[model samples]
Target: MTFHVELDEPRCVASGQCAVVAPDVFDQRDDDGVAVILDESPADDLLDDVREAVAICPAAALRLVEG
Candidate 1:
């Protein structure tokens, strides 16, 4: 199964937790530190880290959809 990452930019709080947990899949904007999706469809090996990022997001801005 492949997972797609969705980020609600309006809901982001710029906490930078997502980047800390999943650098390969998530990053922060240089100007505002908003969460940015580096990889919309991450590889299976990075799923665990992505899951952690979604769970740890304080603003609940990150979502994972299986397709």
Candidate 2:
């Protein structure tokens, strides 16, 4: 199964936790402080880390949509 991740910008405060947890998949646009997804489908090994990021995100800005 593949999951797509997206950021709700309004809810995002650009804390960079998601990027820290999954740099291969997430990044912060330095100027704007917005979460940028490098890949829609991250590696299987990264799934756990991404899920941890989702759980740890204080602003609830990240979401994992299974498709």
The model with the greatest TM-score is: 1
Clash counts per candidate, in order, are 0, 0
Clashing pairs in 1: none
lDDT by residue for model 1 (1-67), tens: 7999999999999999999999999999999999999999999999999999999999999999977
What's the distance in Å from true for residue 47, model 2?
0.4
Least lDDT summed over 10 consecutive residues: which range in candidate 2?
36-45
lDDT of 2 at 49: 83
- Model 1 alpha-carbon miss at residue 23, Å: 0.3
TM-score of each model, in listed order: 0.96, 0.87
